[model samples]
Target chain A: MREKILKAIEKNSRIDLKELAIMLGEEEINVVNEIAAMEAEGIICGYHTLIDWEKTSIEKVSALIEVRVTPQRGQGFDTIAERIYKYPEVNSVYLISGGYDLLVSLEGKSLKEVSNFVSDKLSTLDTVLSTATHFILKKYKDHGTVLAKKYVDERLKMTP
Target chain B: MRNPLSNKITTIKPSGIRKFFDIVSEMEDAISLGVGEPDFDTPWHIRDEGIYSLEKGKTFYTSNAGLKELRQEICNYYGRKQGVVYNPMTETLVTVGGSEGIDLALRCMLNPGDEVIIPTPCYVSYEPCTVMADGVPVILPLKNENQFRLTPEELEGAITEKTKILILAFPNNPTGAIMEKSDLEALVPIIEKHDLMVISDEIYSELSYKSKHVSICSLPGMKERTIVINGFSKAYAMTGWRLGYALGPELVIKQMIKLHQFAIMCAPTTSQYAAIEALKNGDDDVVEMTEAYNQRRRFLMNEFKEMNLPCFEPFGAFYVFPCIKEFGMTSEEFALKFLEEEKVAVVPGTAFGDCGEGFLRISYAYSIDDLKVAIGRLKDFVEKLRAEK
Candidate 1:
């Protein structure tokens, strides 16, 4: 039941408990209780909407910054990863497994704003050694929705 | 429509369902629940297989029984999903949609004057196909009390000395009623007693909501006597692919293949290839599509309850047949008035059969947003009708 509820919610976050109950052949109260339990247990951390932000009347810039950090004797990469992820501009941070130790994504108002964050703020951190920032040109897809192109519905008006 | 037709064919009634589509197509702003198909396009991966096949130049006709691998996939699919077993080599033959399978079965099995018991309300093609095959179509009017299931009594009542076939359109269209295992169990005795063969159209089998669909052929000793028709149209959203198949006794299939060899030759080669992929990997797609339909089902069910419209909860297919008898208008009259007043089109129940006269079939295959608007329009129409009385 937990897996099924999560699966439905994963595909569509906006589905209500009543409709979920009908889809799963469970009672409304049961589904409601299960979802509440999941939320309380942190099994469901959050319900995020998948938006085609490009469709809106806003221009945004995003950059991916790779950071090489010196490992503190006791804390290793965890302490540095937490500090980087805590920033408001940092949408995501990961302890990557390649040439770079950490991969951080930053969203900003403009390319200059992103560069300022990297040069002035990110480069000044005590543990960081070097940083490489790459700005995204255009997003073709985001959160499973195609963002760069419009999807036209081609179904016919009538069929037998 | 050409000169090579018989007078019998000329007199056959045109479908009220298609007539409604003509009106819907002419109007720019009308939102129709009249089309009896899923609004979703065939999932991309399935379509990609067809595209891949065509790109590979797979345009030649396959064997009269269809590609062996596709036939095996169909057998394995039914076996895995519904516990149905058929010989892929000898007991299955792919045709064009379930429509062609139904027609082929009727043509191969019916002698002139043979009686076929067809339960109503049903999809529009049943009677016409029976007439084209020179069989007598005996209409078995189903009642609302019975939830449109064919009872043992109804079966016995419809049988005559000439009765040769019983057409079971379970998970029935327009009504959205399905016969559970027990309901099917009840009819086995009467069917066995009458020694009648069965033609079961399960095109919408994958759309059952609350329970898994059970094949009538899966009953004890019935597989030998049932011709099961199923296709990619309703389940996989591959309607235009023109691929369907028949699973039955070896003797029956052999005959069907013989007729098909001279007629269709085989289902479109590319569709058969695509269907192989559909059968092999389409379970997830069906589940996803079913989930969408279930959401709309709950919304419509809840709205109908609130509006006092008296709809029997249908757990199969994508339609809700709500009784409109209280409005004191025939189903056609109600549909026309609704269209003119609200610019929303719903298929009148009578389009399926005359017995469907007091209700309407509203397909829930559209997006929930569209359904909400349509339902809202319906609520207002019904409320105005009540207040005027």
Candidate 2:
């Protein structure tokens, strides 16, 4: 039931509780309680809309920064990851494998703003050694959804 | 001008869905819950395999029985999933689609005047295919009370001295009915006693909701007499890829391959290559799609219950056969009026067969958002009809 609920709401978090219950063939009260428990247990962390900011009038630039950081005497990559992720501009922080120790993704108003943050803020950090930043030019797909033309049903209205 | 068609072809009635299709096509801005195919595009990985095959210049006519690798994969799939074994070299024949396999099987097995017992409401091709094969079609109208599964008694009564084949399609279309192992077990004795052959179309096998789909051929002594037809269309959302296959005794399969060699030569080479990939690594895709379909199925069933509409709970396929008998209208009348009034198109039950007259075959292949809007309109339409009554 936990997995089922997560799978159902994973694609559309805005699914109505009543409809979700019906879709899962479970009682409404059970569904409500189960979701509440899941939320409290931190199984469901948060819900956010998948937005294509490029379509909007506002200016936005995003970059993925791979940061190599030295581990402190006692504290490891987690301490440094927390320090980087605490910034408001950082959308995601991950301890990635291979050449990089941490991958931090951030959004800014312009490429210069993003680059400045990398050089001035990220590079100045005590544990930070080197950083490689890749700015995203276009998004063909995001969050498992195609960001281009909307899908139109091309199937005939009726068929055998 | 003289007729360009053959007499036998002329005698077969046009598909009922075809007529409804014409009417619905003219109605602009109508929301339809009437499609018989999956709404999902072919999974990307499988499509990528087809593209890769093309890039590698693997474009050539495969053997009439299809690529040996594909045949081996199909056999492996059935063996792994259904516990049914077949020889890849001799017992498997891939064709244009499950539709082609159905026609091919009928053409190969039926002699002139041999009777083919077909239970309705089923996919619309069996009767016509039987006719085209010069075999008499015996329509066995399944009862809604029976949940549309054919009973042993029903099978025994339908068989006649000339009855040579029983076309079994379950996880059925239009009705969404499935015959369980016990259901198939009960019918096996009767079939063997009557010396009947079976063409089991398990195209919708992956879509069964209540339990794992039980193929009739898996039962003891059933495989040698059964031609199990399945394909990538329904399971892998590869309908447009036009790939399907048959597994059975080498003798029957050899005949199907012979006819296919002359008629189709081979299914699309790209589709065959893609299907090999689908069989090898497509289980997760099938599970994901099936879960999606099952969620929508539960949603529709609950909606019907809330609307006070009587419908048998269907465990297979993406359709719900809801009885609209309380409205005191034929299924066609209800469907046409629903389309005209609400601008939501649903296939009339009579489109499947006369036994489907009081019901409507509402497909759950669309998204829940679409289903919610369509069902909202249906609630209004049903209420309006009740008020008129």
Candidate 3:
């Protein structure tokens, strides 16, 4: 039931509770309790809308920063990742494989602002040895959804 | 000038859905629940395989039976999924689509005046195809009380010395009914006693929601007499790929290959290659699509209950055959009025056959949002009709 609920709400968290229960073939109260329990357990962290900000009039610039950081005494990469993710501007922080010790993604108003953050705040932190920042100019897909034009149903209105 | 059409061809009526399609096309801003195909695009990986085959210039006619590798994969798929084994080299014939497989099977198996028992409220092509093959079509009107399943008694009554083949399609189109193993077991003895051949159309096999679909061919003593027709259309969402195949006794398949060789030369070369990839790596894709369909099926059943509509819960395929007899109108009248008043188009059950009267075949292939909007209008229409009553 947990897996079913997560799979159902993964793409559309705003699904009606009653409809979700019906779709899962479960009692409404059981579904409600299951969701509440999942929320409390932090298995379901948060829900956010996926917007193609490029379609909006607002100016936003995004970049992915790969940081190679020296491991601090006992904390290793966890402390560094937490510290980087704590900033309001940072969207995600991960201890990554390959050449990078940590990967951070964030958005800002302009390319200049994003670059300023990388040079000013991110690189200045202790144990942060070097960083490579790559700006995102286009987003063809995000979070399993294609950000292209809306899909029009090409099938005929009626068929057999 | 002499008439160009054959007398036999002229006698066949055009598809009933084609008439309704024309009506719905002219209406602007109409939401339709009348499609008989999946709403998903062919999975990208499968499409990529097709594109890659083309890029490599593998675009030529395969052998009359189809690509050997694809035939082998089809056999492997059947063996793994349904526990039915076949010799790919001798027993498989790939065709343009499941529709073509149906035509080919009828043409190859039926002699003039041979009778083919077809359960009604099925896909529209069976009766016409049987007629075109010079076979008489025996209609078995399945009962709603039986949930549209073919019973052993029904089978016993329909059989005669002339009855040669029975066309069985489950996860049935328009009705969404499926026969469990027990259901198939009951009919097998009668089939064997009558020495009848079975053409099991399992095109919607992957979309079954109740349990794993049981092929009639898999039952004991049934393999030699059953021709299983399946394809990538509903399963992998590759309807436009035009690839389907049949597996059965080597002698029957040899005849089908001969006719297919003369008529089609081969199934599309690129599609055959893509289908190999589908059978090899498409299991996960089928599972995901079937899960989505099942969810939508449950949602529609619940909505029908809420609206007080009389619909038997269908456990296979993506259609709900809801009975609309209480409106004091025919299925056509209810459908037409519903479209005119609510601008939500659903297929009248009579389009499938006369037995489909008083029912509407509403496809749940659309997204849930579309379904919700369409059903909201349906609730209002039903309320108005009840108030008038």
Candidate 4:
């Protein structure tokens, strides 16, 4: 019964407690409580839609940006990074140790807009020392599946 | 001593396509169009050369960068076909497959937090590989309205200061989209202005229809910034042969080769020999096989229309991305139900990315007999689903 519920949740994350109880021949209260426990335990990670973003026409742009930064006096990497992250154009930020100090990734409407953000918004920030931007050209694969290698492996077994 | 499972490895979800394929593998005697490989066998002449090389005991590893002969052949092949040429010794480094070439290219170019722009709905490796390289993968979702081709305006919109590399896979996989020369012309100026590196995977270079495949490297001043990745997999029916090559500036190839040497040593010797043969005499084979795929392509498109699945005709590559959202189920739910009810295995589009949620990628690499059976099963499955309601 637990396995069935888990499998159902894996398939349709947004399944209501009532539906799950009906499918599992269990009480709704019990199913809801189990889901609550799973969420509290972190087993139920997230409920996500397989969004077809094209329908929205939001024109969202995504790019990965490499940033180099120097820590400011009396402030550490996080402090400066926090300031950079506060920008509306910056989507995600991480401080990585390697060829660069802080890695800043952002999205914007145009190349000039993104470039200007770097020059005007990000680079001028107190601790941001340098930024190297690279635009994405094409994607062959994304997420966990090789869209091209769908069933290339004839030997992969079914989820029984 | 310990059960030796690392947290990182355990946490990463397995490939969703592979997961579905695993399910299909358990069924008894189901004809499938689920495979992503070419239906044609590797050309006989190429196989013979590989066999001959083994008979002659050329069994040792080649140089870390791969055999000099294969690189030169690749250079000549690209020049003859795609109007791009790189110094074989300096610019070319043969890899295990286009897959490895992509991994190595990302690893070499990206710093821990660097950003990589990836366009979708696409093949599945770019974003994951970026993450593994400790780089952020920013996805720019392409629309079916544009035939799933990435516009230059879209490319320009996706760049930011932390962007380190752009991976361009064309004569694309799932969508069968190709970037014509005109598209490349539109994209070059932005790339030039940004001083960004372009990794172009043209592994399906020879499989295009309606227009020839265009290499970003063919554009003026673009060669220096572009890394052209190709392999014998799709065109020459050499998927298992496991040979591919990446061509780029010497510096970039050098770093990539260093990573390749440490991690992989060299591509398989037998496969390398087969590739040399493929590079030399595989064009006619590619032409023949592509012709067959095109025929199947037409058949599948008509089937989708007749079945009322609403598919866009693909211009290149072997797969069709058919919109399946009308089924009122997510792509995964539909794929699973279709497999269970009809026993016809197809990949859910959501396996590619979020934008792919409402569609399915149907490969034409299966024989027409198998495709016919699969399509029939799908028709029945849809009818049954409707009837039950």
Candidate 5:
């Protein structure tokens, strides 16, 4: 029943409990209660479409910018990163050592927009000292898995 | 006036290889074939030179680039063997190890957000180094049909305006694949057209069987765009000594030397002297070891065939990557269960990359005695598993 409900939800995110119960050969009230419980427990994060932004109407240019900044008198790296991260354009921020203090992953409509943000928004901050930007060529893997490949290929077989 | 907790300690996952190695370290009398390094001791002559250097009180740092003698020897070694000529003073910089050469090269070359093309199922350091360098690592999965070789098509596809450097770790790790001269010739035009830099890690150059290891810098019009990284580790069994060198355009070497000067003034003085001796008198030992490795290579391939595991015949290096998917588990699961059940250790292919998911890399650098023992254990383990099923 669980697999059936999951399958129904997977096929159609707007799946209703009555239709899900019929598909799973279960009672409607039980199915409705199960989904309600799942929702309450936050196991069902709202349904989302994997928008292929590449084909979407919005023009987005993703770039990774490395920023070197000193902390303010009372604040530290986390504070600085958090302040920068509040901007709607900035996607993520990582505090790294070596040459740069912060690595900001961001997206904008154009290169000029990104450059403008760096000059107007990022560098204008009290702590920001310098910035170097490198745009991404491609992302092969993220979040512990391949982003493109369907499955690992296996060609060999052995008999039991 | 500084805070007591000035350094915020960040806890990260321990390296998976070290995690497995630590587990194996606890097992008494385990015949392991897990490590990727060669089993042979550093050649006696090289060891003697290191001892001699220490005895002579040559403990101080050499030139920021490295000892002139060692660099000259490297120049001679490459020119004699691969027809590549590099000025010792300008084109060369000796590093802590090939590992350091890799790090320094990436650090010097990549501006933030630049992309470095790395073929998958490679040494694990490449990805982390790219991230640490603030460069994006674009992994191009090499197909099995290409003999695990990165094709010109793949190279062409992976390139973009942001692509900066291409890491070519030929006589590859994990898979014993070597790119032939013709194979490299095909890539030269593509690389040249893009005007991109190539970091070629040819540390296993001396271990090749069929054809000699070809330096990408040896190609016409490639010297300006290539940094050839080689070391005494795999060649002279000097992994512990930590001696490696890179030769390329003087400008790149200068930038790399600047970084090295600030961070590490010089590589170990003893290692440098020892490396000079290895370059001078190491070819015979390399030949003998390659012969030994070839024999083991044949044995391992035959064993894989008998076990009905498909394995491509590797031309260089000592690893045999065998597809182990038929056992009904991911590579990590299979490796863990195998080690638990049989007490034999091998690196799961997934540790290299996603393409390695169904494979397991077995190094044949151990003695014939250990190889025989490992094969017997493997046979027994497989039989027991089948019986249980």
Candidate 6:
């Protein structure tokens, strides 16, 4: 049941509750309650609307900052991950298993703003030893949606 | 110059749906809910098999009974899916399409003046195929109230001494009706009492929403008398591949293959190869596509209900037949005017048969976004008609 509900939501997040119920062959209230329970249990983390921001003229910058941290006694990478994720500038933080102990991604108003955060806050952490930041050039795709128009439906106007 | 056409062939009616398609083809900015074909491409793995067969230079025709491998796959698929076993070597013969399967089955069985009981509105070919095969086409108008299903009484009432065959298209076209096991069980006694052979077209079998399709052949004592016509088109998105097959008693399949050997030589070698792959590996693809089609079907049914258009809930096929009679327009008039006024195209119900007069067949094979826009346009069109009244 969870798999079906999750798949339906994954395909189209904005699909109506009534439609979700019909697709799963379940009662509407049951689908609603199941979705609510999934939300409460964190099985469904969040819903997102995919946008092709390249179409708009908005200016933005995003960067992934990889950091090598000293693993603390009992509080290893999780505590540092929590600290980095708590920052408003940080979009996501993972305790990565690589030369880098933590991988952080953040978005900013401009390149300068993103670089400033890396220098001023991320690198200034007590346990932080080294940091490497790579700025995103453009998003050809994001969250399973293609950001660019690569193909068009040029099928014959009618078919039997 | 004298005409070269045979009067019998020329007189057979073309699909009324094609006339609407012509107008749609010429018009720009038109959104069609008309065509019954799927929007999905044939899954990549199936296509890859076709390519692999070609690359191997396996392009020569197989025996008229089709490749033994493909026949085995077809037989195994039905044995698992419908619990009906057929001898792959003698009882299964592949054809060009489910269309050809119908043609071969009719042409093989019918003598001139024999009557074929066809429940309509049905797929466009049944009537014409019957006529072309020198059989009289008997149209049994299925009632919307009966959910467009052919009841046992309807079956018994249509049978005459001249009636030799019954054409059963479940997961029906235009109407989207299906006959469950119990529904089909009721017809068996009627069929047996009448001694009628059956041409059960189950091309849209995999698309049933309520449950898996129940083949009449799967019912007791029906297999020997029924030719179950199914193909990869509706189920595997392989319409362009043009591959279908018939499974039945050895006597019938032998003659059908003889006719196919002379007429078609064999079903396309590449398509047969691809169909083998589809049968072996395409179950997940069918399930995924069917689920997607169901979501669109439910959405449209809900939209129709909200707009107060009385639509029977269809559990099979990717179509919704909404009664447009309340708006005081014939199905064709409503469809044409809707296309002209709103640029949204749906088929007039009468295209399927005269009994389809009061309703319209809207295919939900398109994306949900397209269905939403078309439904909104239809709602506006209906509102305007009400205002004019």
How do the residues B38-139 of candidate 6 rate in per-residue lDDT, one tens digit apiece? Answer: 888899999999999999999897988899999999999999999999999999999999999999999999999999999999988989988999999999
Q: lDDT per residue, candidate 3, B1-389, as tens digits?
A: 99999999999999878877888999979999999889999999999999999999998889999999999999999999899889989999999999999999999999999999999899999999999999999999999999999999999999999999999999899999999999999999899999999999999998888889999999999899999999999999888899999999998999999999999999999999999999999999999888888889999998899999999989888899999988889999999999999999999998888999999999999898899999999999999999998
CA lDDT scores, all candidates in order: 0.89, 0.93, 0.93, 0.80, 0.82, 0.90
Per residue, candidate 2 scores C-alpha lDDT tens digits across A42-117 of 9999998999998899999999999999998788887888989999999999888898899999999999999999
C-alpha TM-scores of all predictions: 0.93, 0.97, 0.98, 0.70, 0.68, 0.88
In candidate 6, what are the lDDT values of residues A87-119, reduced to their tens digit? 998988877775778889999999999999989
The reply for model 4, stretches above 4 Å from the true place, is A1-160, B1-11, B386-389
- Candidate 4: residue B163 Cα off by (Å): 1.1
Docking class of 2: high
lDDT for B276 (candidate 1): 94
Worst 10 residues of 3 chain B by lDDT: B14-23
- What would the per-residue lDDT of candidate 1 be over residues A1-160, giving only the tens digit for each residue? 7888988789788887776786566799988899999999999999898766566888788889989999899999999888888889999998889898999998999888999888888899999999999988878987766778865545655554
lDDT per residue for candidate 4 within B199-248, as digits (tens), equals 89998888887778878898899888988888988889888788899999
Better of 3 and 4 by lDDT: 3
Off by over 4 Å in 5: A1-160, B1-14, B386-389
Higher-scoring candidate on TM-score, 3 or 4: 3
* TM-score of the second chain for every model: 0.98, 0.99, 0.99, 0.96, 0.95, 0.99
What DockQ does predicted model 3 obtain?
Answer: 0.91
TM-score of 2: 0.97
> Compared with the true structure, what per-residue lDDT tens digits does model 2 show for residues B225-327?
9999999999999889999999999999899899999998999999999999899898999998998899999999888899999998999999999999988
lDDT of 5: 0.82
**Model 3 residue B66 CA deviation in Å:** 1.1
Per-residue lDDT of A49-122 in model 3, one digit per residue for the tens? 99999889999999999999999888888888888999999999888889888889999999999999999999
